[model samples]
Target: MSLLQTAPTCDPDDQWCVWVSELTGNDWLAQAADWLIAKPLALLVLLIIAFVARWLLHRMIDRVTNRAAEGLPTPMLKHKPGKDVPATVLSGRRVQRAQTMGSLLKSIASIVVFTITGITALAQLGFAVGPLIASAGIVGIALGFGAQSLVTDFLSGIFMIVEDQYGVGDAVDLGEAVGTVEAVGLRVTRLRDVEGTVWYVRNGEIIRVGNQSQNWARTVVDVPVSHEQDLFRVQSVLKDVAHEVWEDEDFRSVILEEPEVWGVQDMTPDWITVRVTLKTAPLEQWGVAREMRERIKARFDHLGIELARPARVLIHRDNRAAGEDLETTGAPDGSGTPASS
Candidate 1:
């Protein structure tokens, strides 16, 4: 009976309105029912899409993570002198790093997927998506400003792990904290110093990193001998001692290369320093240097090599002769006042 069959409150192609309008007619009731039914259906679809997308993204992430983990390099720990490179397996540090990366990616993907779904649901329910998004952006900005340091720390840690700048068992000098890394995390790096004091350092605060445990290390021992001793002779003796240390069965395992005497490193009136150096395994420099010094000392004792010693000369007047008492007013105290000797 009515030429205007389309509901004014609903879209022309809205299927929900058309389906329910067959019984209720194209009236307010149809539109009301369409809203009640259509909005929920749209929200349901969005949720399904969100879940599917999240699943796909997570699966992709897992695949990529596994690949990365399997192909991970072993730069953080050097290859042993006489051993081949170990295979990358889901164990030890490589697995730990892969797990960290995968978890972070999954979390980000979930947040993004769910957030988009929520916004779409709100828009479907007749809420202004623009203002909602703008308000969310403002709130996000506020939160970012408030938690800048936390964000920086997290980002820094991620990069540190990815780039293999440092890791557990690495002796690192991270600005104020210089020690062996005990644990690495997203926000803080734990270290234990030579004194065994544990340090929790925020990753964001580290500027430059000095990793002393990666690759190989060098041991330098400066042996000072009397300047009067022949420099060439001391250098030969130091070279011999260094070679003995490097060849010793106990020290040879830590020493990577043959030792060398680097001639004189410094010269003073009292002594000349002979620099002996050895290439050693990571973290083995200290022990190797100590051993080199001990061997050099024992060798010097056997060879009667004179070590440098501080010297000072003091002169006194030898006045025990009869003519020495002929002085009239020589001050024995050395004061300006005249006095009898």
Candidate 2:
């Protein structure tokens, strides 16, 4: 008889037939078919959910950034008498900070979500995830011990972002590197120097930072003139130059205050250095200084104010064939020569 028809070998009163029939029933095939189709669908659904979550997270971050940016006070809206922070700079910093925070959040969320998804997918594939998790923990500990510097870098970067130490587009001097910040990340900072060279600096390595574009800057101009020039005249000319620059419509907004002419910073044999100081908006000092120099040169040239020049003096010695007495006297050219007593 066929195997299917020979099932009466077991007693009808016994439970063995019932158990064997159940084991061989269509129910197991249905369950197998369902699992064969459902597991992959479940994994796919999970991945889709992860993608959606990431998108939503980024959307939320963008919303927060826009709201925060809107709340920032414009320079014209709130004019605090000595506060030099520009509205544009503040807005830029806010956006940069928000982006940095968003990147960090997204990175962390992706790690967690992907890790969970992977574990779940593995479990669906009939793998023991508990042992895997334990092994991952051990590996993580070993990596942590081996990559202490990396940990320190991430920690430092977090604090740096939180404290707003520096941001992209800011000119910073980070002890070892001086350049404009191009990007700030959890482990590294990218910079572009004046020479167009790019640098990647570890966040942990930056102990101190000098931000040149913050708030305000001072433009210092040292003009050297012939020592014999009238000091008061030079001072008056410098003051005039400062006043002109301050009142100019193009530069009026950049200059914060009237220029101060600090007279006679130093006196050398050939030149007297007069110091001119001006308080200007951040990043404006260089342009202002250059313009001031050009204007001052024109003014000096127009007024015939002589600048310092190198001077040379010569000494003449005379020798007679016989033992003759020699007398010397100072000449107008600062030279000494034999002369009649």
Candidate 3:
């Protein structure tokens, strides 16, 4: 103030001094200086808040996962011989589903928290956020219209996880592909089919899911025998095979109940099919069916029980000789005797 009072007024012709006087008298410069000094500190605080919120969000998700897991039954399976089976634990599918859900929650929380933090930080820097928020809303609405399929996929994925429709390691038949689920994400599910081809299926496109590894499964073994074989004998043999498989120590745990022999399911001209049904643990039906088939085949072979085989017919014709005889015998007259060559 003292220097300002002692200084002489600048001449209108002196451009440099006039410019300096205007710059020093401007109030906006000081405001800008204060803003510059405070912006970084505000931004740092916002970053800290975002990180803390992220940590809290993850912790909450972990707690929820643990509580959900607690309500589930401990999964157990027969271990290989001579190997120690671990204590009871959650099923592979359950654990994977929990983990996937936790990751999705964390990701969504981070997105929302960071977005809000960014908007707040922008407002602190003296930027108008109302227009930005309005613009974002309009853009979101436009995107919703343009990306309906994307929204459907995300919603379907969310419901799929929440309802526990299918999870990793579960075998499912999605109208287009039948395979084991390898990964389930927000947009798509990855499956590996029997041929080992990995398939990426959009969640919205899966209208129906046939989960084969849930609860229990039925092992159906169809044994076809020749029509010549007695139906009663075949039924008896199949019953014996089923009983043996059920009683076997190696497969005992997989078999939930005694196997049933549904006698004479179908009869064709050449064969009669007998059905053997076994109730087995989830995912064990295939192995049980295969083992039952092998055992039945061996038993049939040992007992000389004939399986249905394709019938072949042979036809013999002497067209050339018959034509020659007809030509020699025809002479515009009826003749009962054969013509001499």
Candidate 4:
């Protein structure tokens, strides 16, 4: 008779071992003692269940969030008078938040699934998890207190999500630093600057943020010229240039309203500052400004106008006593020699 037949009694001490021995009609208890071998089918089934649960939960969350967000009008895409401009529609802020929400939901679902799977597996192995959970709770509380910054980061991240201040792909000015939001998590936000440098800033530490791509960006161009240049001629030249630039296919597509020259904004003894404003598409202001600069330089060069800057034309002089005077002794017309002291 196998061990299972002999150990038919329900003894929790060696229930699985005895059952396996009885079914196999062999001393598998020795192998079980040496190594706790888990059945592949059971492990595979558990993992599959966990994976499916995670997938289903994630899909549900994404579907719900997307539907809800889509139902509500997104401010980032809508213009609000002076607060927003026609260029706001092109900003990626709203869409980026949707994607970020999806990612966060997916992460949460994965964690929930894994935690359930771990607990289920532990239960199946006949391990008592009550004390483990209690101990874990205590440890977590202690850790939370010790690592208050971590808690602050987590809380701040939650608030950030709720407020929707900025999201991935949105251009933001984090204090003095400016960058596009690449990723936002429970702890840190990743930003890619214009120079391609990535900054990882903790959410808790970010006290204030300036989101440039929130709705629309305003660009101001200042062109300074020497006071010698004619003011009316400069304004007329700028007007003609603006018209030409506006007519251009490139600027027309990016510019919403006609470019306006604000006339002579300021005048000083050395230079005059001319201001021009253009209503451009979001993020297109840079290109428009650059094109305007090129046009200004070309027009100025053609008009024989020079850019103003500080300059000096120095004339050196030297005075000496009667005994060491250049007027007393000279070597040549170009060179002067002082009299002997």
Candidate 5:
């Protein structure tokens, strides 16, 4: 009875339907044949729709990825006029990010496209879909609890990408690790420190991020002078030194603006600290600071500037009245007596 159940509507005049009914001498057998033929046609339609949707989504992803790779203008970051993008300045990190994002999006599209098609096709084939979806939801919840950390990592990585928190080649401080990011993934981020030690930090474990290579950096130099030196004179000399560096052809490219001399950063009995600061392109701070130090040393030496030095005190003690005996090992007679202070 179940096998002979009624099929969906079919014309009595259909040649195949009629042929099947006559050959088998049963109406139900002909209806079953018609149902079988229709199922394949429906499945073929679903397959075509799925493939088209996937292809369209993949193309969109590729377009966006290519734009990002070329440094497309964003609200936060705009490309400057007349500056070519990434000829020599093009780095591997940007390309990698684009590729990774593209691949992830494509994979997700494929999964969604195939999943929907499969569920719909199953329903068309007369299988009950409600129970299967319900069971899938329960299984999903169980997996969510069992693999909470993995899900957290995946969600965190997605947010980071969407928010543009940090990327490869960026110097960041990620709580337990501080270094240059070498690779970024949905689960872990790889970093290489100054000592060339690589660190793998979990994306879920990152609480806060300190990105040092975002836009610009500042170079700070503190010049310590003898406390007795004239504050005005020291500041003037420092300003001259800073301006001199800024004017240099080699430094002009990196320096963003005029250097500022912040007078009297700190004052102690021994020395007065004069702080100078310069704004430079990202990651250029160290090189500019080194240049500033070298130039300051040379200029200070040329002008005979007095630098602060540690003070030394000498004490004289007479031990004749003390109960302790004084000994002088250097008694010209090769004696073992200890020397006097």
Candidate 6:
């Protein structure tokens, strides 16, 4: 009975000693493991908070910017002679400028957010960012010399913005390339051609610019009437057409000034050139001119006027068979045919 009792007590003491040893060896590791599990959850929560904060900040900034621009008078909102202003849409240039500014602001905001998140993530992982920043500076300096063109482009873009050389939706001709300015940015200018192709021109390379969509555009139309038609009659017809076009539904909105007819600009044996000049709103002159041409055709056709083309009434005579009566003319040599001069 004494031996059994002694054995049980010794066994219980040994078990207790083993449990203490295990705790002493694995305590720090257990705590570290628990922290590792919780770290990911904490990071996820932080990222969610950051995302929500960024969205709210963007909305606030956008609202503030829009509110500041509310008092400005847009072209679309202005009262014109024969135009109606719709309150929903802003003017072309104003809308374009707004979009460009918004893009720039969003880009800057995203850069800021990304930078903060990256730094926070690195710091949370127990990394020293001071050395990283120092290395980044050295590398940036080293790359600066090779990236002079990029620097020039950026600087030129900023100057362009300050100077307001041109803006989106403006019809500009840059050297040999002519197109509508679709977007203007710090590094490059985007252009869209009539063919719907987009061109990217570097800002630094633009030395000459032709802006066609400025205040006004001129529509010059040349109408050719038959030489047989009376000069006064043709001029009278054009003047009437111009007056009617000024009151036209489609053209009344675009024509700022009535078209003035310059009579008999040039004369030929078969045709007389009549010139019509008009002052039209920017980018509206083409449609106005096209409409005038259609009206002119209708007017000429109604008045029984014959418009001639550039073709010579050629006299074809077989010199070898000159004595033979030219089939069309009774006279064998009646100047064979009156060749159109």
What tens digits encode model 5's per-residue C-alpha lDDT throughout 233-316? Answer: 888888998999899999887788799998889877667789999987667888999998998889889888888764533334
* Residue 127 lDDT in candidate 5: 93
TM-score of 2: 0.71
Candidate 3 global lDDT: 0.77
TM-score of each: 0.64, 0.71, 0.74, 0.66, 0.72, 0.59
lDDT of each: 0.76, 0.77, 0.77, 0.71, 0.79, 0.69
* lDDT string, candidate 3, 66-140, tens digits: 645544432221112112221222245456667777777888898999999999998976689999999999999
- Candidate 5 runs further than 4 Å off: 1-45, 64-104, 124-126, 313-341
Predicted structure with the largest lDDT when compared to the true one: 5
C-alpha RMSD of each candidate structure in angstroms: 9.7, 8.9, 11.9, 9.0, 8.4, 11.5
The reply for model 6, stretches above 4 Å from the true place, is 1-49, 64-90, 155-170, 181-186, 190-198, 214-216, 221-240, 257-277, 294-341
Per-residue lDDT for 1-341 in model 1, tens only?
45454436556677787777777666577778867777777888888899999999999888777766665444332222224212321134455556667787788899999988888888787789998889989998998999999999999988987766776887999889899999888899999999999999999999999998665678988887887788888888888888888788998677877888889898776677789898877788999888877888888899899777644333345567743422233232332332235
Q: Give model 3's TM-score versus the native structure.
A: 0.74
The digit string of per-residue lDDT tens for model 4 on 1-341 reads 76656643434455555666667655546336323554444566899999988888888877766654454444322212454355245334555666666677688789888988887777666679898889989999999999999999998997787578887777888885689888888999999998999999999999999876555555567888887878788888887877787799866766777778898788766678998887766667778788888998999999887876533223333655433323333222334443433
lDDT of 2: 0.77
Candidate with maximal TM-score:
3
Off by over 4 Å in 3: 1-38, 72-90, 319-341
Rank by TM-score (best first):
3, 5, 2, 4, 1, 6
**How big is the positional error of residue 16 in model 3, measured in Å on the Cα after superposition?**
35
In model 1, what is the error at residue 251, expressed in angstroms? 5.2
Stretches of candidate 1 exceeding 4 Å from the true structure:
1-107, 117-128, 146-155, 158-163, 244-253, 312-341
